[model samples]
Target chain A: MTTPNPTAAILIIGDEILSGRTRDANMYHLAGELTRIGIDLKESRVVSDDREAIVEAVRALSAKYTHVFTSGGIGPTHDDITADCIAAAFDRSIGVRDDAKALLTAHYEGRGVEFNDARMRMARIPEGAELIDNPVSIAPGFSVENVHVMAGVPNIFAAMVAGLLPRITGGKPLLSQSYRINRPESTVAEPLGDLAKRYPDLSMGSYPFNRDGAFGTNIVIRGQDGAMVEAALMELATLFPAEEHS
Target chain B: MTTPNPTAAILIIGDEILSGRTRDANMYHLAGELTRIGIDLKESRVVSDDREAIVEAVRALSAKYTHVFTSGGIGPTHDDITADCIAAAFDRSIGVRDDAKALLTAHYEGRGVEFNDARMRMARIPEGAELIDNPVSIAPGFSVENVHVMAGVPNIFAAMVAGLLPRITGGKPLLSQSYRINRPESTVAEPLGDLAKRYPDLSMGSYPFNRDGAFGTNIVIRGQDGAMVEAALMELATLFPAEEHS
Candidate 1:
């Protein structure tokens, strides 16, 4: 039997998401990325930028999951309190590390801008934390214990994730396949239920839809074992033989 | 001083969301709707279809928030165990109620389809629960205790929310205003910080953006009092008057 993969939880730290002023792109993007790498994303939480809230969520998620990836609250603004909260969560002291400060110092000086106190806020890191590279912007995200804290901006979050993923050793890649049956979900449930029981390890889901007054259900089968996923999909396809669309 | 609004938490129940097969729209939509009515969305969670996971999340969220809204896993399939799980969370007895079955029975009969066991599964709501109307489909969502469970489909979820929200008593309507400053967030941080401190009741956020190599920050001031939000925006405008977006 294949060993179980590491479980993860995403802590999205922001008021914009909670207030619904901004639609969350970081969680969606990170979910897909984590899945491809076989790190099971068990759950995700979105909380506001409040200090107590951030600290509580960080501690709770860190204790529950193998890894916790957080997006937002790691910028150079007074509202950006993720770094300090992370330190408080882990009971570690946080200050401006010389290395992180140097990166920002050079980035600002090269652009003919002063590395002022407001800008220097980005260089604050918790003690014993490793820096996460931010290629899009010079200010870096950091990894403290099992939690990886990153920026809230879409492009910078994506870039930091791209650079940090290679450092994480993932389990077997998750594989998936889908079949669209031109029938209502009620009609498709019988076979799909039997199919699910037949392959206990695989995950099967039936999503119903209506298109131009025609009802349809998309049955998706997902598993770590590629052969088992293909076998189940083949069995399902034979029962409801139709044009193939993957 | 205005009374604080009721707090909410969203528990999204589906493996599709956790596994990255689906991007969550319900959470984003609900966040915006709750804000308009001044039901503060404190946090949101996305969990898999596992029974224990669903039960744990429901109980935790229900205990902490004034209302806990759940979306997905209430369908005509084996994987649709949200009804049973919600019952388990509250320790309430669950079975196919006559009224719910009657709705499905009439619905299927009118469409010339049999109301089979799979379809009957949708009628299995918890004891002491009030049914929430579904306009798009005959299958009804329900509210047991403080948790309001609804369908996961975008259109149906929106429809269910449209019907369910008016029943809730909300606080004062949340008001907001924004000004886009064509300056780096670091430059805008000082004034925004002072503004936030001046109006401790209002929430001010500085969202940084890089538009075609030009740095800018959108300063948003939000509060339940329209006059307070307006006054803050005016103060901000006087400091750096360029243009108003919201």
Candidate 2:
């Protein structure tokens, strides 16, 4: 058993999200992908397109987790200050890198578009950082220290993650099994609590839902060991003795 | 003009969210509502069901923003440790409150169900805290210092926000206007940057979207002053000289 699973945190940077104008897709996508690969997504944060807030979040999350992934604010616009803020977080210098510029230059040139100053902003990278490939867009994401700064756009973000995840070392993949009880959480809380206590290694989560006036709880058991998870699920099933919904 | 709008942060506590099993609804709901009432939702964080993480987030967010709203972990289950975490963050004692217990008791009794010990856990409140009414469920949310602890369910969280927002004093409602350019963000970044600099009081946000293989940007200008926002939008229109989409 891997004693300490690799942990990660996501930092979403965009005013559009904070203003409730855009529903976040990056965090949700990253969470599922990270979990499938055995990295525990311990925390996630969404901050506006502000420099101080981004820098502060970067420093804090980077120090706390084994990996930190940031989405948004890497666009051509003036509000896209993520690159500079990330640099400040690590006390590193930032400038337009030739390799990143070459990628953007070739893509734009092939498309018969001018590589203007705004577009060139995409090439800005912190010193001593590795580039993360963006297959959808030519603008590349960068990894400085433990933090990976990627695009905010969902398609581009997804492409970058596909290229990046396999490079990072991961522990045992977390396996989860859930049982849906047709009773309210209040009915299952007591016995479920005891079941959780018995299997201290696994994580027990109860999600209550009200579906068409019928209240129910979806109890999920997560751990690295599938055998332990199966045992706990059996105990939970015996304790509840209800028809399983899932 | 309200020079500085009231700022807020949301701390969502649940393992289901971090594990990617649940898509968050409360944060999006609160963000729109807070923006409508002129409270800037500056930052939002999702932490697991760990007590240390919950306490740390509560303390950090409460100090940074004028208001902090928390969702989840207030339920009857053992993983519902948010109430205790809130108390610990502020160095206060927490226990079942009479008023809160009475509410839950009447609710369960009306439904012809027993108000068991687990159900009574919903009545836990921190010292010197005020209850936020939950019309959907009898479980009450509370506000201690600047932090407001609310439920995780979408409906309950919305109802609680409806009841809570009116009581808190708010500045002028934030007004916004958007212009959609058929061109990419790279095309609109330069002129929009100028427009933002011209009207420094207004917040300029550019959101890029790809619809049916066509890329476009929706430029939004927001501020307390409607006239300033309108003026900025007009300048933005002239700068772009294209058909407005929004």
lDDT of 2 by residue, B1-246 (tens): 457889999999888888888889888989999988888899999999999999989988898899999999999999999999999999999988999999998899999998998998889899899999998877899999999999998888999999999988766778999888988899889988987888888889998887877789999988989888988888888887765543
The residue ranges of model 2 lying beyond 4 angstroms of the native Cα positions read: A243-246, B243-246
**Between which residue pairs do clashes occur in model 1?**
none
Candidate 1 per-residue C-alpha lDDT over B1-246 given as tens digits, one digit per residue, 9 for 90 to 100: 778899999999888888878899999999999999989999999998899989999999999999999999999998999999999999999999999999999999999998888888989989999999998887999999899999998888999999999999898878889888988888778778887899998889989988787888988888888888999999999988775332
lDDT (0-100) at residue B122 of candidate 2?
89
DockQ of predicted candidate 1: 0.78
Cα lDDT tens digits for candidate 2, A7-65: 99999999988888888988889999999989999999999988888999999999999
Pairs of residues at least 3 apart in sequence or in different chains that clash in candidate 2:
none
| Share of true Cα-Cα contacts across chains kept by each model | 0.72, 0.76
